[model samples]
Target: MPYEEENIQQFSATSSSTSHSFLRSRIGLVIEARETAAAITSIADAEAAGVEQIWMTQSPPTLDTLTLFAAAATRTTHIRMGTSIVPTYPRHPLILAQQALTVSDIAPGRLRLGVGPSHRPTIEGVYGLQHTAPLAHLSEYVAVLRAALWEGRVNYHGNYFNVHATLPRTSRVPILISALREGAFRLAGEISDGAISWLCPVPYLLDKALPALRAGAEASKRSAPPLVAHVLVALSEDENAAQDAARKRIQYYTALPFYARMFADAGLPVAPDGTGLDALARSLVVYGNEATVVQQLTELLAQGLDELLVLLVPVQDASRELAQLARLIGGMQ
Candidate 1:
């Protein structure tokens, strides 16, 4: 069967309209340097505002995502805990699976593991792993992790990473992936529960990704995983400033080879402006007034996306941003 047609069939077979049951995005925060007390307080408030999940994301100069999730999970009882995007390298797949299951043991249905092949510099210059064909490396990584997670054992070997029989947490866990390119997208279908996307346009998800995911799920004999986006937002009438903020972020991502390659593939054009990383950072974000952001998010949701994981950027104020997130979600049906 054609990939698109196959996905449509699979989507109809396994997914409910209720897969999109929630439209108002839950507030998802990234920890940079917030103290644990401050972090938990903020997370607790987010939970109060109907935020269901909080992401312990990893990046440069950030604390470990799993430990942070462990910390945040302890403080808030109801909110779901997730790793926004844990890199495939840096540790054995067994350890990653064990950590994910261990957390699941603590939080149960509240745990989601979002995994990906981190960018080149972060993978090489920072963590110093072998910079390789990232798509291939990640493909193998996801398969191994899934087998270990789902079956509690894996007899697998790969070019980059490997695994042996290992039993882990004896409970259900949702393994989400950070994916964009063709290989990563297909792997999400075949191996993962769903995808965790960032800055991937709604059109791509609608026109391309959803169909691909449907096909993958059918092929793999699993229900279609949820399509979650870590949305960058800044709402305002003069969306131009917000656009500028988004552009500042883009600049930073353009320098990262993995993102740069994906951005190009996404058809967003960028010039290598050597105004430094701060200037580039603005290029990679998404911001507009509430109305504009809503319109953009609507475009995203229309493409069959599951839910918005709102990551509030450095904006008016963290408190105000949180309030705005609550207000926006309150209005969504």
Candidate 2:
């Protein structure tokens, strides 16, 4: 049987259209800084600007995302913190659960723990760990995390993990999973609190990714989880210059096989000599001045995204761009 047909047969039930309390349907930013004080300062700045949440990435040679949030928790009062993704292969599920619990303790009801089995090159090549059966690994990983964080104990054995551990208390940290294709999206719907998408075109997300998520939720006899769209935003009037800057960053992903497949599946095939890159950048990035960005964002949210995670493209001054973004978000609210 074909993949889509098999999936349809397997997950034919209807999922309840449920709303999520944890997902406040607000705008957030992906914050990055090299220095601790600078990152914390950025967090405070964002909070002052009325941004609801701040997401940070975790990979080698970067500050541990959770620990940074833990530090930021002491400095800020209400701004929510999230890990865009913490790789599953490196850290054991129980360990991550414990770390997440600490963060939750510091800032109650303010942590969203996002985890995923990252790509093969980064996992195997960089971390020197095997990256086989990633979706299966992620499935088991999320199960363990949900059990440990939500239920306060985990006592089971799975193909990729074996654990029997208990936590001091049940933490309410919503575990979101990173998704690329339908398989990962379905797995996220079945197990995770939400699915976090990066670089997936808006059309593919609405047309293909979301249906798969709903199907998984339907099969599991549950309400479909939220979809957090990670998008690129540039606050600049010069569309061509901003796109040129965006292309430099996007071109790196096009070379990756997984991203290449996703782009192709979305009807934007990548050429070997990078002939079609400008179009891909234009499709993926939202540039221009404040009014244009606001319209683009409003249109995107109207398409059913539960949250917006914007990574601002550095076209002009960073601080100036952040101020403009803050103003735009404030006005929209």
Candidate 3:
């Protein structure tokens, strides 16, 4: 079948709406730990600190996100759980739906499954799998996942996926897609419940991503979904320490081709040997004392962002930084 004809309905089958923050904007934290016990403790801590949501990142070496979420579901109540992104190439859509269903059953109306075709390096270099036609693969992957989780069945046959399966049960798990560029953002608007962006500067989101998302929604004849900005923030009284931490984390992405191009497009280009990291950090990271950081974050939320998925970069102490940041964010709410 043609791709257009095969374009399934947006993943919100039974949902009338799927906005991340319906009334007011919200803030969330990214909880990452090498140990499962530590990560679960972090989730409980975020909940106790009154953090609205907690997102987990999945990599080959990291703990499986769905399993972590299931554990968190049993431990914490009233805090939302989301996957920053679960790579699609590693798991088939049906299998992912099965795992997500368990998490959703444990914590109903609180699981947001964000998925994507991760970068070429991680997908190919780490997994030794051919990283080919990522957006095409991602489009079909969301369709299949939505069919299973929302409608309880899938009969999708695309270039990258051939799935005909019936799920044990349906769920209202809001499906979100990782979007770095305009194309992916548009795809998210058309097919998924929301778009989760990483390392995209605020201006780029306003100038490029939001326009593409609106265009996609206009074409699809549906309301545009929320754009959850993945912001790397550091809460520190010592400016130098915060900038140093931001540089270390921001430099890692400079080596990646996709992120490098995005940086250039966002008007903060780096040298071939990665020399413009300071400029990138200035444009990307929100750091300073409590008052200064809160002001910057407030301005960010004012820029029409539905939610800030804060990846806090610690300057000196991780736990202390998180607790202080959580208190500030709680005050914001």
**Each prediction's TM-score versus the true structure:** 0.81, 0.91, 0.91
Model 1, total clashes: 26
lDDT of 3 by residue, 1-333 (tens): 111221222321222432423212267789889998999998888888777788899999899989988988899987889998999998889999999999899999888899999999998999999889899989999889988988899998889888888888889688889998889889987887788999889999888988887788778887777788888889876767877898888887888888888888898888878688888887788888878877777677666666789898998888888888766665654
Give all candidate RMSDs, comma-separated: 4.8, 5.7, 4.9
Runs with alpha carbons beyond 4 Å of true place in candidate 1? 1-21, 25-34, 274-299, 330-333
Q: Give the per-residue lDDT digits (tens) of candidate 1, residues 1-333.
A: 022334334333233333222544333544344566776677666676666666777776766777766767777787777777888788677788888787777677787788887877788889878868876777787778777777788888777765678684454566778877656676677767667777666656655666777677778876666677666676544556666556555556666666666656656645576443343334345566667766666655554566667666654465677667655654554
Instruction: Give the local distance difference test score of model 1.
Output: 0.65
Score each candidate by Cα lDDT.
0.65, 0.81, 0.81
Quick one: ranking by lDDT, best first?
2, 3, 1
Each candidate's clash count: 26, 0, 0
Tens digits of lDDT, candidate 2, 1-333: 011233233222232222222222356788888788888888888877777788988888778888889889998999889998999999999999999999999999899889998888899999999999989999899888888988899996999899999999988688889998999899877887778899998999989999998888778876677787888998888888889888987898888878899889888878999988988888888988887987788767656766778898889688778767765665665
Model 1, TM vs. native: 0.81
